[model samples]
Target: MNELRFRDVSVRFGGRRRGVTAVDRVDLTVPAGAVVGLVGESGSGKSTLARAAVGLAPLAGGAVLLDGRPLPRTPGRHGVQMVFQDPYSSLDPRMTVGASIAEAAPRGGNTTAEVARLLDLVELAPERAAQYPAQLSGGQRQRVALARALAARPDVIIADEITSALDVSIQGTVLNLVRDLQRRLSLSMLFISHNLAVVRYVSDLLAVMYLGRIVECGPVDDVLGDPQHPYTRQLLASAPRPGGIPTALTGAEATLDSAEPGDPHHPPPGCRFHPRCPVGPLVLPGRDDCRDTEPDGAQRRHQAACHYAAHASEQHNTRSTP
Candidate 1:
């Protein structure tokens, strides 16, 4: 089985004065044949982590391991491939769809046969291969991109916001294709998106990132249904329901300001999220722990990084004590 492990990984850019720490000692694993979803706001380092897996982002500390070996600097060199967000830009507008998919085919492989098979795998008609990117719909283009990724015959495919650009209806079709493909091929995937609903749909395991850290990680349903961290609760509360209505989150007001991502160069000290953590007081009780402590990303069952995760547990136990 091929497993992707991020061991104490960190990514820093620029100098001490101007440098930002995009990813901070995050340890995560995508077991073979599983889909792991990473959900976080823009600049939350989710994309940076994805980039690190594909060797696009340099790591300041730690490493990325594929089945106990280091990931190659160039993707698809060792069965690792990435399907980027914008198919329009990722695919060559100048080249025909068949040509693009053929280019990604394994070395020494029969390109024509591979393109036909991949296009069929992604549910595109064989004739569609003759179409150019400009002639295809957004969903069709994405499927073609997926076909291209499959042509590489990768063990792990990093899908970075592949559905974010499509309409909601089209998003579901693409998501279904991804889920079906993963199961059919037994492929491991690291799916990155900010859409909670979409992530919940496609992932078996979910990791929620805040700022540059994974604040929560667990089974998809468990974490989203019974969120342990304050941020998780906040996200659940803020995420829109089907009717286009924001679910009314009790306790803290929903206030995830749509600001540019935080400066990695100067993240707030203590808990990076303490400044906006509404339920911190409820969980931390009478301490300033949240503002002065850094919680390591050690998963305890469905782990959460807040200092008050234990406190909340204790409180729950206390309430249940008979």
Candidate 2:
């Protein structure tokens, strides 16, 4: 039972900047009771995809279905909730923390009981219920925000870099809280972040995005442990490895820990990584057919638009880990 699914989704702003398509033809699925990690760099449309899932961004094109239902015309406040990156600002500076959670209660729902219930669910003491946003620490503030989103008991939760600014220890604490909450409530979550380490730690599946489209995606362990996509491998390798030599390796030649960015607007004709690709004839021999044109963002579920997926897959099957 998939809780939320995005099919050929695209979100574009009509303002200046030539109306960039923020979430481009992203096809994704949040299986029931799973924490799917939408991992990528900032502005990779992770947040936009989250917003579209919860109805904050318009569905410029494609479908965002909740529980197999196409997004409703009016996505109610309690339908899908968002936990912003900055907890301090995300909470109402003027309102008490308890009040913020109270605001999320459905009109007919047991407002007081639900608010208190969520607060407890997030591991907050009953006494802290009266505290204001200014009275809490960063972690505490985030807990309150999580409580607020859960107050509505939303079916889907879109957490965009929610723990990014917190101390590392605090991040672990908060991540544990989310993990606990997900299990306890059997919730479906879309955890958006640029932190691959964290994603590797928490998510069941991962989606790697660049420019706007998702370049690669699959089971987290498989994708992170043995990435088939060059971009995915580069991203995994980018993190500073302890006691390891820091050297630059371009494209396919690079290890997963040394990820890199590529041209956005005008990606390579066959594959976006062709210019920086360590592999020869990026589209490769058998994949020469894919060189005719790059696939649009529309096909997202388990495919990379790259012309070299087959070759890449074959390489993955034959080569040693980088």
* TM-score of each prediction: 0.91, 0.85
Candidate 2: which stretches are off by over 4 Å?
A: 15-17, 73-77, 108-110, 242-268, 280-292, 295-302, 313-322
List clashing residue pairs in candidate 1: 19-265, 20-264, 20-265, 21-264
Off by over 4 Å in 1: 75-78, 249-262, 281-285, 310-322
Candidate 2 clash pair list: 233-256, 234-259, 235-259, 236-256, 236-257, 237-256, 237-257, 237-258, 238-257, 238-258
Output the number of the TM-score-best candidate.
Answer: 1
lDDT of each: 0.83, 0.75
User: CA lDDT of 243 in candidate 1?
Assistant: 90
Q: For model 2, what is the error of residue 47's alpha carbon versus the real structure, in angstroms, after optimal superposition?
A: 1.1
